[model samples]
Target: MAASPTDTAPPEQGGTPGAAAGFPSLEEMQHWTWVIGRMQQMMMEQGLAALPEVPGVNDAATIERLHDFWSDSLTLWQRFLTPGGAAEPGAPPADKRFRAEAWREPAFDLVRQSYQTIADHLLRGIDALDGVEPAQKEKIRFATRALVEAMSPANFPWTNPEVIERTIETRGENLMKGLQHMLADIARGQLTHTDGGAFQVGRDLATTPGQVVKRTPLYELIQYAPVTDTVADTPLVIFPPWINRFYILDLTPEKSFIRWATQQGLTVFMVSWRSADASMKDVSWDDYVRAQIDAIETVRDLLGVKAVHTIGYCVAGTTLAATLALLAARGEADRVASATFFTAQVDFAEAGELKHFVDDEQLAMIAALSPEGFLDGRYMAATFNLLRGRDLIWNYVTNNYLLGKDYAPFDLLHWNGDITNLPAKWHLSYLTDLYRDNLLVKPGAISVDGTPIDLSRVATPSYVQAGREDHIAPAESVWKVTQHFAGPVRFVLAGSGHIAGVVNPPAAGKYQYWTNDAPAESLADFVAGATETKGSWWPDWQAWLAQRGGGQVPATGARVPGEGALPALEPAPGRYVTQR
Candidate 1:
């Protein structure tokens, strides 16, 4: 069956099935007994490439940790062999992998405990390395984690009690279905995270009422109808990350930030980006900054307003910051009345595990992988999956390929699976200039449209928000933006990861945010002084907008797309979002 691509490891494109390579004797000998093992062979097909070698047991600190590992293993073995109720060693806290009741058996329990013990010691041993740089240590840890996650017994049928029980109950039919799933996935060259058929862009997702007012080679501008009789005088334009479609902000109506914002007495506009193609290889950072400026100007022209409020979520936020800088450099800072950044980092110095992938070798590999200068989105998704290997990769491997279960029907995962390509020039610029060189935050360090960008000159009032647990844009890195912007900044820390933290709507009331009236340069000090608040940060943000002279007027006079300056190209959520 055909499927949408997911943000996990892609299937092996051409290599032979791993079982064929690992067990050449399988074809010559009886294969019935090895059915389960054969079903799991493909999981090992894509090994971690270019992992840094970790420090071995050379020093006393490392030797001591190794001894502790052995000592723990001996204790677990003794407990397993001893008399009844000798207390089976516990698995790591909150580890759902071994939660199956079938795993309560002494042997499987021992397997779980043993895996946990070694994994713990392995990490601790890395901590004991003295001379390694912090960044190098993190890279080694990331690579080791991928290896450790792959080695879990739960990934294999023979050792996994749950899989074994299911196999016996189904009389081996589960293995048959699992093998079929494995082959189907291999043929598609991508993993299926959610039921792809469960949702479509126009029908179920991105269903908020709107029209594509302007379409360009780079992006489409969407102007949504207002819900209230009165709207703020200034329209709010949202620039979502182009990695995926804009629907993430306009999911189902209940979850749609776009829809909800309209009802909050504000005119809403969205920038739906076109996925990069072969021709866009040379469309660099200047084009993106110009695109953002173009969108802002387009919104202002359509509304007949001097300035409009702006938002940049994730990468869009980073681009928006650059656009702001560009505007400031040109003495046109009034174009954007107020700026809001959602989980965006102006400074990459304290970025998370993603920084490890920015070095020269991997980038050359990435460049070689995409000959047309159009990097397939799956490769980026694969890198993201590596950061959360267990939940996003191995979990799906166990469920879809080993247990023969269908993936859950989820809206978010559907959006996540929709892959988009990136322009190589823009991508390389981001990796080398922003991430590797840490140049974006430096005044005049990088130029957009040949104009040097100076963040200090960007005196536009700003609201900076970060997710406390965000791995992609670490909150610390995000918090540093507060120090760079010359304008008054209010920093809020949300209570989730990157996607969830930003997408949270007020009506959902799901996660809380923290605020600190007391000023602090460091995120730790900022967080320590922050007061916890209940519910979503949306209301707080809306209130912030109102404070910035986002004054309201009767909505009966408010104009819709095609009714004013620009012609409505088509009904939104636009042709661009649904293309893939």
Candidate 2:
């Protein structure tokens, strides 16, 4: 330092004697390295734990049992494999081989690990049994023994391919008839051959009635009735799901809900969702809500009514709820007097197996396929078929195609086949936000026009009905809606599935429902303390509506306009019916 400042600089500091060091100490570096290594180890362990374990070798007694079971299985397999046996001489190998080099050591280790795990679990269970009461111990022992018995491989049936073939051949004619019947139905109007025997007769008997009266850029208002006396005071508006045609409610004289309501001294105005084409690709949920609101206003102004009662079915109910929520937020509740929902999904927490089809993966696939902003009718039909494969898919496969019988001409089936295309934007939003995320029940989770859909704000007296055997919309899922509405709610559990439940006529037979004499504190509490009654919910609903409808004012003396130059010329069934 006395000679020169630069020469006196410390090597570590790269400066003169008093300069401070910048680099970390060896001990600190080691500590950081150890921390990073530990974190990586934890991540690796977690990754391994996430994987499903492979089944392997058993303990001594269990091994002996499994060996005997496998010996029998191997013997059966050998019999099938034999060249001279009933099975064909050259058949594909049934066994799936593992990679010997990659899997052998791991498989052996897994076997050892599995045996150890079983032994440990068995010991723990025995120890736990020792601490329990004698009766409880006996019950536990019985349960454990039953579980073990259930786990035995012998419990499974040995499916013999030859036997299966023989049985199928024995009933081949009936099966063939059923197959032919289904194929005939599928090909009916869609296919044709040169021969007269293979000509198409597409849905000749299942034609939908009602023509479009007026077509707007977005929708066509389809009128089905002879414009008779308009009951201005008790004007009714039907909100059918856009997924199907409006004819579902007006199916037939006997099974028609709209017809029944009209006969009940009410003027009905039904909304037929116009099938969307390329022009309507950008249509959103907001557009639907606006269209419906406009419809209600149009009906009121045209008929000179103060307000109207609205009935929504299935997905339409959700739309109705959204509209009501919007109205309530904007202080426009005076437009609607009351609302009725038929098997609507307000809360989707317990949506059941339908949830499987609307999961992230399926929805992504739908989005990819429907990039143009509408789900194809064929895809929708396929999804619905999967929900009840045995009924919708296999039943037809067995009956129509296999049996070669003519399918009975039914309006409901025809309507079911005539599926509507869903706008891609709305469909994706519904799947991701409502079904998957359950945003409807979650406060402030959904909104329209930047205004949140607060379900509690839906104060209009509501009548919600759910079917007992509804596979699509289960009773439990529908019942969840009671808590979401702040209004006087009547929750009715009906007697059939999605379609039959809503289409239920008075003469259908005894149906049942549950209602609160007084509003319950919560849906769960209400159900827990509720009593079940036997009878049709239809009469109960009729009584309820009559009470709220203010004893039905005398029929207004207004007449509906006739179809011609007086009403503007509209396309047949309008353009919407054929959009999808």
lDDT of each: 0.80, 0.60
Best by lDDT: 1
The TM-score of candidate 2 is: 0.65
Q: What TM-score quantifies how close candidate 1 is to the native fold?
A: 0.89
RMSD of each: 10.2, 22.7
Per-candidate total of colliding backbone pairs: 1, 23
Residue lDDT tens for model 1, 73-129: 555544444344235456533788888776666456656767888888777777887
lDDT of 1: 0.80
Q: Give one digit per residue, the lDDT tens place, for model 2 in 77-142.
A: 232223232233232332112112211222122222233334335444643443587544544554
Model 2 alpha-carbon drift over 4 Å, by segment: 1-55, 58-214, 222-232, 518-535, 550-575, 578-580
Candidate 2 C-alpha error for residue 554, in Å: 6.5
> How does candidate 2 score on lDDT?
0.60
Best by TM-score: 1
